[model samples]
Target chain A: MSIPLTLVLGGARSGKSRYAEGLVTAGPAPWVYVATAQAFDDEMVARIARHRADRADGWQTVEAPLDLAGALDAAPAGATVLVDCLTLWLTNLMLGEHGITAAIEALEAALDRRAAPVVLVANEVGLGIVPDNALARAFRDEAGRLNQRLAARAGRVLFLAAGLPLTLK
Target chain B: MSIPLTLVLGGARSGKSRYAEGLVTAGPAPWVYVATAQAFDDEMVARIARHRADRADGWQTVEAPLDLAGALDAAPAGATVLVDCLTLWLTNLMLGEHGITAAIEALEAALDRRAAPVVLVANEVGLGIVPDNALARAFRDEAGRLNQRLAARAGRVLFLAAGLPLTLK
Candidate 1:
């Protein structure tokens, strides 16, 4: 049987991570928490540490800022995977100059191989004023494109605002 | 009868303006286009021009770059009003050092006086990575608060992504 994919998309502080975590912890314990964040500074370090401390017991954390597909593939059999975010992963790919299209394909293939349901979280970055820098603009466009692509294939899609869920699909 | 207010919230290029226009035109002719954009540079001018050129006939355009409340109050009795966006109006307010709280309250009061239906468009600016500057951060926060506030009272609220609407209320 095929596994289901749920994409939770929202803005900063919109409770996307918490919401996705709820979905993960809802089913069973020993959930796989795939962390895409890479802490380079104090702010990011604190954010990462906070997320780690906030999660309840029975979560197996996997740090995969760049190797998300590999991380997903390495998950234990029949484990529900919750990728807390793809935006940071995409940021890492872009900053590290990785081939994004190929990485996306690999991630998709890994998702296809999963035996358990998976939920992916991403940010909706294209709804505001255009960013000043060219790189930010390109990133926003790519992020929006990636979101639309995944949303099309996901079994369920949600747009979150102020901690409320609006089912998009 | 009390007027109905619909708030269309979306990211940049998320088809917010187009979708809100559809709602306005669905009612009757001679609709009011309450524009809140100020053309200070080539980009701004170009954007305003493009939006102006994109609209269909029967739109009575009103330049309300700063006085959106006044514009709304004067939107011809029984005319269905479409405010292309509030983010820009907020920008103008902040730039002019206007009292944002009072402005918002006045705008809400103006909305209450409408004898016909009204549709408001706004950008969802809080979803992406936090901005670098304090001013931008404050703006984002205010925009979000404004959206949440209006959305609470709005008869209908929509969040747009990839040009698709997800009902939030």
Candidate 2:
């Protein structure tokens, strides 16, 4: 049987990562955390540190600043995996000038190959006013499209706001 | 009995206005469409015109770019009213250097007195990464606070994505 995939979409500080962690922790211990955030600045460094301190001891984190598919592939079979975020992963790809389409396909293939439950966390970035900068606009558009695609492929989809979860599918 | 109030929150082009219109139109003819959009650019002018053309003939449009509370108070009793958005109204308020707190109080008072069914549309703007500018950051925080306040008072609340509604409350 195919493993269940869940897509958790939320805004910044909307408790998406925490919620996804809870989902992973519900079934078993020793979960794999595929973190995609790159600490380019102090703010991100602080955030990454905070997230690390938030969870319990059973999480084995795999850093995948650009190689998310490969990191997920390295996770053992039947071990629940929580991908802290896809937004930062996408940002990494864009900044690194990697092909987004190909990266997404590889990620999809990796997900298909998984034999354990996987929960993907993503930011819902397109719900706000259009940005003045071209890059911000393009990023929001890409984030929205990515979210819709992942949500469609997932068995369950949830939208979170203000630390509350609302099931979308 | 207090008339039902619904808050429909979504990103740009997420079909929020259409959903709110549906809620108003389900009741009776001659519904009030309280438009808060001001066409400062050609794109906005075209978008406003398109939205007007998209709706049916039963809508009585009211231009309330700043005086939203006053315009809302003018609607007849028992006539369902659809406020196309609060985001643009907030933008107008901020750009005009108006007092946001006082205006929000007036709006809340206006909502409290309404005996007609009301559907409010607002863009969810805090989901993206931290914006580069202070103004955008402030605007998003204000928007988020506004949504939360109005949502608490609303009889029904929905968060929309890709034209799909996820009931939040």
Candidate 3:
């Protein structure tokens, strides 16, 4: 069967993760949750715990902070896979001083070869004032470019706001 | 005839301002540009100057850092008014220790009573990760709420991305 790829975009606390979870849960069991966030600080630890509590059983969690494309390649065929976010993955790459273009190219290639349906969540962060710092501005620009690329490739694209989803493509 | 109100929302450099200008210029000649930005830094001064140069002739510019409602009220009847942004105005009010709730109420009241058609441009800033600082978190929360309120009142609401307009309402 041809694998379906979906991209979900939203702002902070826009209920995008929950909405993406709903989409995957409605399709198949034995879901794989590819968590891209790392526990760098106490606040992140708490946030991660909250996300963990929000998910029910039947989810196989994989901690793929950097090797997202590899994780997708290893997932079982026909079982739905969800990458909780792309922005966090981007953050991990930037802080790790990894080449962003190469990583994104690998991710796109992996998505192309994946056998199972994959849903990706990302933040829409460029719609605000330019960040006061150069690092932040660069990150926002990268996020915007990344989102555009994913949205173009995904079979479905959604923008979430206030817990509601608007189909973009 | 009753006044028409439009709200154009987008991310940083998403061409929202240019799109908003097109909407106004399509209707009439004498356009009022309500700039809510305060040129505090060199970067901002340059940005403001760029925006000024981008605008065409037959434009009346009003600098309203904090008193947006007053500026709207003082605009000539039956003319077109474009409020460049709301987020900057909100920031001004917050830093100035102005009452947010009262000010929003006054702005909404003014919008309702204005005789001129008003087009507003605002940034959608809540679609990213939770801000690390309390002040930034507060600003994002306030921006989200303000966008919701304005969208509710707007006769036409649009979400712009990649220089394209998506009619939200």
Q: Provide DockQ values for all models, in the order shown.
A: 0.26, 0.25, 0.18
Query: How many pairs collide in each candidate, listed in order?
Result: 4, 1, 8
Cα-based lDDT for every prediction: 0.88, 0.87, 0.87
Q: What digit string (tens of lDDT, one per residue) describes model 1 on residues B1-169?
A: 2569999998876668987998999998769999999999876787799889989999999999888889998878889999978999999999999999999999999998887899999998886677888899999999999999999889999887855687888
Q: For candidate 3 chain B, which ten residues in a row score worst on lDDT?
A: B158-167
lDDT digits (tens) for residues A9-97 of candidate 1: 98888999999999988997669999999999999999999999999989999999999899999998789999979989999999999
Regarding TM-score, does 2 or 3 come out ahead?
A: 2
Model 1: residues with Cα > 4 Å off, grouped in runs: B1-9, B13-157, B162-164
RMSD of 1: 6.2
Q: Please estimate how well model 3 matches the true structure, expressed as its whole-model Cα lDDT.
A: 0.87
User: How well docked is model 3, in DockQ terms?
Assistant: 0.18
Query: What is the lDDT, from 0 to 100, of the residue B121 in candidate 1?
Result: 98
- The worst-scoring run of ten residues by lDDT in candidate 2 chain B lies at B12-21
Give the residue spans of candidate 3 off by over 4 A. Answer: A1-3, B1-8, B13-157, B161-165
Task: Evaluate model 1: give its TM-score.
Answer: 0.60
